[model samples]
Target: MLMERYMRVSQAYDKQVYTEDGIYLGKVEEALIQDNSRIYGWQVRLENPKIKEALRGKGIIVPHTLVRAIGDIMIIARVSIKKEE
Candidate 1:
């Protein structure tokens, strides 16, 4: 089942993530997609309001590929900006 497969992929990933956590952080400015490899993940751009509000001034970019499923809820791979670039 496609849905099942997607669920598995999503469940395998998608976890809680925080920026600096100590101060006002930023928002997702942009996303850098990693297409060279088949892995799932992306690099997020942190700037402006996104940065000001970000705990770490680091935005999160979830790869569309990692998003194995998007049904009642949007699902994605458990990825981190630290692990992206």
Candidate 2:
């Protein structure tokens, strides 16, 4: 017999997040929802030491489109963030 793993929104909180390039980005601080059924985005609390200087005092919002996988940790695609003017 085989079992399947199912994800729950509640379990996402505090889960570690990483990039496909192997960058330990941060932990899942919060999640956004749309229409009360779809996940809109993820608010990741930046914590990686490698990019600390660039991301200091900034929280990353990973859009659902960028999310690659959701298992032990969240895996997101490599993306460039543009500052809003």
Candidate 3:
């Protein structure tokens, strides 16, 4: 819950994440913590079909620093998604 404001970790999960430009990215799957004190990043399930297929069904990790705000919905910086051949 270190994104802009703070909240319970439980409240963090299942939050729909979006890019700053308002593109729906995914939902918060897991929060990456460090040493048990700090959160480093978030593991987000790929909801966008194109991104999901490009990621091979894997999730994306958004760094904590990129997070702008968090509440009912989480806002973060735009992430780069490259579809591999």
Candidate 4:
């Protein structure tokens, strides 16, 4: 699904998604938007301690371009930091 379609249905504090080799990462604390209009990505809150231990933080931003799918939940193409650089 397109990010714009997701923006129409989803809201803040909704679950954000993460994946690496098809594994789930965590849920979202907030959804980020572009120009205050469509969703640009999200602010994901890490749930697993293993992930927390790895990230050394509570949350991170994800971009809409990285989104692979949106079904029962939001799906990201890969697991990563907020930005590339």
Best by lDDT: 3
Sorting all predicted structures by TM-score, with the top scorer first, yields: 2, 3, 4, 1
Q: Model 3 shows how many backbone clashes?
A: 0
How much is the lDDT of residue 42 in candidate 4? 72
**Can you write out model 1's per-residue Cα lDDT over 1-85, one digit (the tens) per residue?**
4444433333433332233232222233333435754544533444436543543544556565654444443444434333223
Q: Report every candidate's CA lDDT.
A: 0.40, 0.78, 0.81, 0.65
- What C-alpha root-mean-square deviation, in Å, does candidate 4 show against the real structure? 4.2
Model 3 per-residue lDDT tens digits across residues 1-85: 4555557887999999898899887899999899999998888887888778757966888888888889899898776433223
55, model 1: CA deviation in Å? 6.5
**Lowest summed lDDT over 10 consecutive residues: which window, candidate 4?**
3-12
In candidate 3, the residue pairs with backbone N, CA or C atoms under 3 Å apart (3 or more residues apart, or in different chains) clash, namely none
Candidate order, lDDT descending: 3, 2, 4, 1
Q: What is candidate 4's lDDT per residue for 1-85, written digit by digit as tens?
A: 5445534435535564658456556786666778977777677777767766777887767787787776556677664555212
**Residue by residue across 10-76, what tens digits does model 2's lDDT show?**
8999889888988887798888999999999888877876565576555678888888888788998
Off by over 4 Å in 3: 1-5, 80-85
Local error of candidate 1 at residue 19 (angstroms): 16
